[model samples]
Target: MGYLRLLRQRPILVLWSSAALSVLGDRLYGLAIMWVVYEATGSAVWMGIAAVVESLPYILIGTFGRGLIARFSSFGALGWLDAGRAVVACAVPLLWSPGQGGITVLLVLVLLLGTLGVLFDPNLGGLVPDLVRPDRVREVTALLDLTNRIAVIAGPGCVGLILMVVSEVQLFAIDGVTFIVSAAAMWWLRAHTHRVARAAAPGAVTAPARRAEPVAAWPVLRRHPDVAVAVGLHGIGFFVAAVSAVGLPTLLAVRLGQGAAGYGLALSAVGAGALAGNLLIGNLRAGRWLTVYCSAWTVTGLALIGYSTAPTLPVVLGVGFAAGLAAPAAAVTLRTKLAGFVPAQRLRLITVDQTVIRTAGTVGMLTLPVAVDAAPATTFAGAGLLLIAAAATAAATGRRVTAAAIMSSREPAGSQTS
Candidate 1:
């Protein structure tokens, strides 16, 4: 069958569509967010805080929620979370009145929005294998990567234009409506019956027997050393991701004096770069060289940090694109590896792994603004340090992970018994 026929057979395309919808809102939210905060408080500090609130908390949330999701059906949990995100995304745009327009309100709204995000991501990832064929996981992930790239490029651009034309309320309302579409699409997904990839290992798990979910990240990861290392290495990419997403843009606009548009342009470059990366980079034939992926993002963060001092749009985009390229490749690699290491039953926890990867990025988001605001030009150097730390930690230990994978291919132990 053709690839299009494969997409017709599964929920992945639909789920991927849902992701694209949310990402459009996600980008719009980014544009709207910067505009509202920058225009409202007139402080880059507020912008910093808003970014932090949106991205930072996921680390602990995913780290802890990994347990909670393990208990419920990943699909059920995701559906409810998707519903909640839609409600919140809808409500946030309405949170404005002359008297109510305080930094406090924006901060509160961001907090609420961030809280919902914590639940949404992992559950979404958990749905993938349940949706697509095993052999095609990487291809599907790459496609999703491409979808996100488009969203990143389009979100801010559309929102930026909307801000020029309409009121914040209307832009926000549109964003909310997009969320409604995204959530509704997710609801249409057949959660219970999506096909799983790992159903055929020797003593492979049968559908009926492996229903009891494992609760903690450690338990599942402990047995799967390979995946655990992949998660850590993925965190390197995440660390760089945070830097590019939060640290560089703020530094460019505030310290470099390029303003919000500069920041947006720089990010769009990263998105464009990532789209290019997905197209150009593939083939898990040398998958064990996970360090190469870590190095890619580390270079991204470091280069971006250095680019912070440069006063050119093209320079910013160039650096951002390199980072972007590394980011998605890292993501594609880790997700593909996770599919190999995990069972059908542990999809949610695996999703949590993806979430936690970004959660690490969130940690960077939390600190980056303050660092940029306080030190101005030098904060990016701090980002470089963060990226390097993540890279070195992962690189030093990734071989152990590769070894485990080698062992798994020899004999898959986590295979479920029917």
Candidate 2:
């Protein structure tokens, strides 16, 4: 009911619609390109290269390009980026050939799309708080997360049906159309709303003069230690998640003697759990965000540990479902907390968060495979234990920070009478 109420508002409706379309399109594009690349090359190595090339931009841009991203954290700029992606998506089929030259061109296009994505993703996170009433930020965030979960669940199936009737290349064209539609919706929002502009305007009181200067995220994060802790823990969580991503299938094969079908069921369970979590969070009023965030990670860690000991497919699915359920609570709360910062610092902080997550995931992907191969169950349990420890540390640190701040506030201003 709450999600339905939020969806009725025109701006929220438009924004949600665009997000749904764009995210689904992204899924289509990603699967299509990977399929096309592997088909053309018949090499897993090329597929791996393509995946790395696509993910590398997030790390690069998030680490070094925060200021540039801040400057373009506007609806119009975001719309243009979507438009650019549409062109790039459409060009893949038109320009690609069946040789190494074509594969090279496809990788280049993928890289370009990824770069644009890095620019667009954090800015969108920063934009959501500007688009809605402050009380509804969490709800909108949940809605967005829900959209992504739905896309993850349905995108592949949709692609499967499409591939039965059309070539993989045509999926890019459909993805292109979705981007164009999203761009149009964004531009409409730009024409209708002034909150973001007013908040960012130089003369506005909320937009401090200091905001014009490029503020580094580190100093800003240092000033807000809780957010810093959340960001750190989020990275650790992603690292653990990457380990599970690689280990889960292997576990299913060796332990349960299952293959793709089991893996698919596990994924669907997670998606279903995530969808339920989003709906629950979206309907409820906001609570202590940091506590919810930490607790979610703790539960996630427990779920990972559960995965290691799951003896049957049903048990594995249950563990997967629990992990998925916790993910959205952690993610939505973290974003809701990040929304509390000023626009300039908010975008930069989000960029830093994204950078940390992407970097951790990349490292996990590269370094965890051998460990996973040697000991899948141990890897799962170990990663789970590490995540739980990180969550506890973050919670303890947050408590100390809160206590110190309170004590400082209570102290006399001029107590040194001597």
Clashes of each: 2, 0
Candidate 1: global Cα-lDDT? 0.64
C-alpha lDDT of residue 218 in model 2: 80
Output the worst ten-in-a-row residue range by lDDT, candidate 2.
Answer: 205-214
Give per-model TM-scores.
0.76, 0.92
Q: Give model 2's TM-score versus the native structure.
A: 0.92
| Candidate 2 positional error at 236, Å | 1.0
Model 2 agreement with the true structure over 1-418: per-residue lDDT tens digits: 8788988989899999989988888888878887899999998678778878888899998888767777667777789999999999999889989999999999999999899989888888887797788888888888888888898689778878888997988889899999999889878877766555575675765432122234698877666778888999999998878777778889889888989999999999999898888887778865677788889999999998998899999998998888888888998899888888888877888889998998888788778878999999899899999999999999989877866766766889977645
Cα misplacement distance, residue 345 of candidate 2 (Å): 1.5
- Residue lDDT tens for model 1, 254-315: 65677867877777777888887776554344345466666665776577575766667777
Report every candidate's CA lDDT: 0.64, 0.85
